[model samples]
Target: MIEIRRSDERGHANHGWLDSYHSFSFADYYDPEHMHFGPLRVINEDRIAGGQGFGTHGHRDMEIVTYVLDGALAHRDSMGNGSTIRHGDVQRMSAGTGVMHSEFNASEHEPVHLLQIWVLPQRAGDQPGYEEKRFDDADKRGRLRIVASPDGRDGSVTIHSDASIYAALIDGAEQAALPLQAGRRAYVHVARGALTVNGEALAAGDAAMIVDAAAVTLEQGRDAEVLVFDLGALNG
Candidate 1:
């Protein structure tokens, strides 16, 4: 079964300095029906004003992944990790017991657009950890490139969750496919441009929640950039 979630159907919030769209129930945007998809708990598309961003905050028992689409994001965490991530960079932080972090736009004049994802950890109470990696456009062009996974396969950032995340950049005549094992599920999110997923048309910000499927096919892309999540049990 595959269900399409339109871009406008997501919950939206704007705080002058930040504009965000939540794919799942988050903060004040509660939706009982859209709480989560498998172990994927949150997908927030955010645009932060230049020089403004989230202050020091705490999280626990969650695997947080940050993907910057445009501009740069400066990050600092309790683990003493501090750096700036631009487009093509993926950052993962496992807030096992607890961790404090802050993220701000690296530029003083350019806003930063990004996606912040939260995956429920497979097991709680592990020690906190952090990892970052860069996947060039050439690496993702016309294919689904693994960016985050439980085992950190292919140099992807590691996450303490039973899920694998893939990124892709496709244009006309380019296509990709990811075969799924029995009982596995998939969530496809279009980060930019338009594309067709398993015969379903999707625009930027759109997503496809798939289950009991044999594979996820992406094609007929119009300068599309997408992320696919291969998930485990639904009760994460």
Candidate 2:
């Protein structure tokens, strides 16, 4: 089954300094039907104003992944990790037990656009951890590159979850495909530009939830950059 979720169908919130779209129920944007997909709990596309961002916050039993798309993002965590991540960089924080963190735009003049994802851990109460890696455009051009996974395979950051995240950059005549195993599911999100996923057209902010499918294919893209989540079967 393939279900297309339009860009405008997501829950939106704007707080002057921040504009965000939630792919699943989050904060004040509640949707019983869109609570989650498998272990993938949250996918928030956010744009933060220059020099403004989220203050110290707390999270537990969740694997948080940050992907910067446009500008830079400064991050500080209870794990004593502090750094700035720009485009093509992926940051993963396992808030096992508990953790405090803050994120702000690294630039005073340029807004930062990014995607914040939360995945449920395979087992709760594990030790907290952090990891960051960079996947240059050349690494993903015309192909899917694993960015985050349970095993950290292919130079991808490790996540304490039963899911794998893939990134791709494709243009005209370029394509990529990911084969799905039985009982596995896939969620494809277009970060920017336009593309065709498994024959379904998608634009920036749009997503395709797939289940019981053989594979996910991307083609006929127009400067498209996308993220794909290979997830386990839905949990009750």
Candidate 3:
């Protein structure tokens, strides 16, 4: 079964400096019926104007990830981690017990487009951590490149959760596929461009909750960037 969430149906907020779209319940965008799917908690598409950003924020027991789509994002935290995440970069922070962090546009002219994601950790108060990595363009072109995983396999960032995140770039004639087990589920997010998931067409900002499928296919599409989550069950 596949449940589709049209882009326009999501909660949207347009701050002068920060334009955001919430895929699940976030801040004032609460929707009890769309709180979350599997272990994925939040998917916020954010665009921060130059010289602006999020001030120090606190979080606990969540596996947070930031994927920079365009421009650059500067980050700093109480954990003594400070850096700039640019396009093709993936950043992960494990707020096991608690952590404080801030994000800002790294450029003085260009705005930063990014996705801030949250996934429930497997256990509370395990340990605090941070990691960042860059994936080759070839790795994501025409295929899903695993960028985050529970075991940190293949040089990907480690997340304290029983799930994996992959990114793909599909253009004309390029495609990819993922196979799933009986109890697993998937979340597909379209960052930009147009594509088809299995047989359903989706455009930028659209998403799908998939289950009970033996395998899924993503057809290469014009200017399309996609994120896929192979998620495990959450006890809640």
C-alpha lDDT values of all predictions:
0.97, 0.96, 0.93
Clashing pairs in 1: none
Q: How well is each residue in 1-236 modelled by candidate 3, as lDDT tens digits?
A: 99889999999999999999999999989899888888899999999999999999998999999999999999999899999999899999999888999999998888999999999998898778899999978889999899999999988999988899999999889989999989999999999999999889999999988999987789958889999999987753
Task: List pairs with backbone clashes in candidate 3.
Answer: none
Per-residue C-alpha lDDT of model 1 across residues 148-210, encoded as one tens digit per residue: 998888999999888999999989999999999998999999999999999999999999999
Residues 17-46 of candidate 2 have per-residue lDDT tens digits of: 999999999999999999999999999999
User: Worst 10-residue stretch by lDDT in candidate 1?
Assistant: 227-236
Clashing pairs in 2: none
lDDT measured at residue 206 in model 3 versus the true structure, 0 to 100: 98
**Would you estimate the TM-scores of all the predictions?**
0.99, 0.99, 0.98
The root-mean-square deviation over C-alpha atoms between each candidate and the true structure, in angstroms, is 0.7, 0.7, 1.0
Name the runs in model 1 displaced over 4 angstroms.
none
Superposition TM-score, candidate 2 onto the true structure: 0.99
Pairing residues by index, what is the TM-score of model 3?
Answer: 0.98
Error of 2 at 102 (Å): 0.3
